[model samples]
Target: MLFKFRRHWETPWEVVDSKAVKPVYMYYDDEDSLDIVAVSDADTRGTYVFEVNHLTRTALRNAVTFSRQQLIHQVAKKGFNVLVLESWRLTIFRRGKSHRVEVMYSGRPAEALGKLPHLPPPPFMDVLHEFM
Candidate 1:
């Protein structure tokens, strides 16, 4: 039946509830420093906005993990555009108290590693489809 077929092919984007999910962020600064902050209700719940340092191996790995989790939740393992995935980034505030927003997801593991200068891609990409 058409209903069954549609259900079979549907890709579920699992968006976390703003109230229940506690989003977290790990930022890297230029001096090999890592700063992590959890996104609370006072801040944007599901959005990451800041200029965290992306130039460390661990930082890059963490960023990939963060994005992968969200993407898996959103796309439900139906597969994603590699090009699109490689183009995503997590943006954040720089040197001001201002809370302006931006996106820095490059979807590419290589790009993330580049920021660190010496690192491999996160390990989670290997099992991205298992959850779907």
Candidate 2:
């Protein structure tokens, strides 16, 4: 087996949530974002860490999704209920015989002033729900 191979960046593409509103809201850039400030307590450059032996082919499409969700959970622990002007980078590589996916996201963390609104899921989300 080759010790080194060219790395690819595609696995991270499948695990993305484009929803505009949620408990931990996400925005790609300042052009369309909320009025919030960046909090320093949260981990901005969160890395995806996992064991290769536990990797499964079916889970590949959801790896980045998991990473981002984990980051949000951690930030919430720090009192951040929302994130704005967010961006993420994805990486795909091989560990031994398995292909692994990772995601690192950066965003301005903020606490919503009042009760965060929780609207019904977008109509388009029904397509996703059906697959579950």
Q: How close to the true structure is residue 129 of candidate 2, measured as C-alpha lDDT?
A: 37
- For each candidate, the alpha-carbon lDDT, in order, equals 0.33, 0.49
Q: How many backbone clashes does candidate 1 have?
A: 23
Q: Per-residue lDDT for 105 in model 2?
A: 54
Instruction: For candidate 2, report its TM-score.
Output: 0.49
lDDT of 2 by residue, 24-93 (tens): 3344345333444545654364777443455443353355456557766877888787664355554555
Pairs clashing within candidate 2: none
For candidate 1, the TM-score is 0.26
Return the TM-score for each candidate structure. Answer: 0.26, 0.49
RMSD, candidate 2, Å: 9.4
| Best-fitting candidate, scored by lDDT | 2
